[model samples]
Target: MYANPAATNRFTVNAFLNNDQFACVDGYRLEDTVTEVTTPTNQPLPFVFNATDDHAAADALRTLSHSEPGDEPGQKWPAEIRSLNIGDVVQVTAPDGTVTHLAVDTVGYIEIETVGAAARPAVHPHTHA
Candidate 1:
C-alpha cells in the first residue's frame, strides 16, 4: 500500500503526522484546521491571497497564519487580501529568480480554506511582484 520506499518508510512529516510542510509556495507564500465543514463538494472554495510585494500581504499572511479554528479568519485581514473561488491564476517569483503562475488549489484543511475563500478581496490588485 505504498508508492515509493527509498527513505523514511512513510515517516515523512510536517505539522500533522503523515503530512508535509513547505517554507513557500512557488517561493511566494507570505503564509489551517478543523473538520468544521461537511460539504460534499469542493466548488467555490474560500481563499485569502496577496502578493508578497506589499506590506498588506504580509499583514494578511500574519493574520491567516495565526488564526485558529472557531476564530474569525476573515475578520482579521489587512485589506490587501483577495477572495476568489474561480481558481484564478497566481504568479510567484522564487527566491532563485524563477517565476511560475498557478491556479488556486489546496492540499487539505477544508475548514480553514473555507474561511479564506469567503474572506473579502482587497481593493487593489493582488498579483505578486
Candidate 2:
C-alpha cells in the first residue's frame, strides 16, 4: 500500500562536519524505509534518497551545494564543496517528537539522471573533504 504523498516524511539535509544547511526536500519518500544499516566492511551506512522529480527542489539542492550556475558570465562558483559528503547527515523529525538521523554512505538520484532531464544539470551525488 502506498502512503499518502502529502503525509510523507520531511527531511533536512545538512553537513555532518559543521551542521550547515545542505538541502531541504520536503515530502520526499524513501525507496526503502530502513532507518539504519550495517555494511560488511562497516564503511558507509547509506540511506536511500527517493526524491520527488521537482525542478525547483532540485535547483534548491544545487544552490545549497554551490553547484548552481551563476547569473553572469565568468562567474566563479562558491568555495564550498559542490556535493554532499559521505558523512553528511539527513535529519528527520517525527510528529511524536522523535528524531531519526541517516548518514550518507552513497548518494543516488531519482528521475533526473539523463541529460536535459532536469531544469539544470543534475548534480551527481558525491563525497567531499
> Highest lDDT among the candidates is held by which one?
2
Query: What tens digits encode model 2's per-residue C-alpha lDDT throughout 24-52?
Result: 33212232221111223433332222234
Tell me the RMSD of model 1 versus the true structure. Answer: 18.4
lDDT of each: 0.25, 0.32
Clashing pairs in 1: 46-116, 46-117, 47-116, 47-117
**TM-score (all chains, Cα) for each model:** 0.23, 0.27
Model 1, span 14-53: residue lDDT tens = 0111101331233112121111111124122222332333
Worst 10 residues of 2 by lDDT: 27-36
Residue 102 lDDT, candidate 2, scale 0-100 = 42
Query: In model 2, where do residues sit more than 4 Å from their true spots?
Result: 1-8, 18-82, 107-129
User: Cα miss at 69, model 1 (Å)?
Assistant: 14
Per-residue lDDT of 79 in model 1:
29
Instruction: Kindly provide the TM-score of model 1 when superposed on the true structure, using C-alpha atoms.
Output: 0.23
The window of 10 residues in a row where model 1 has the poorest summed lDDT is: 11-20
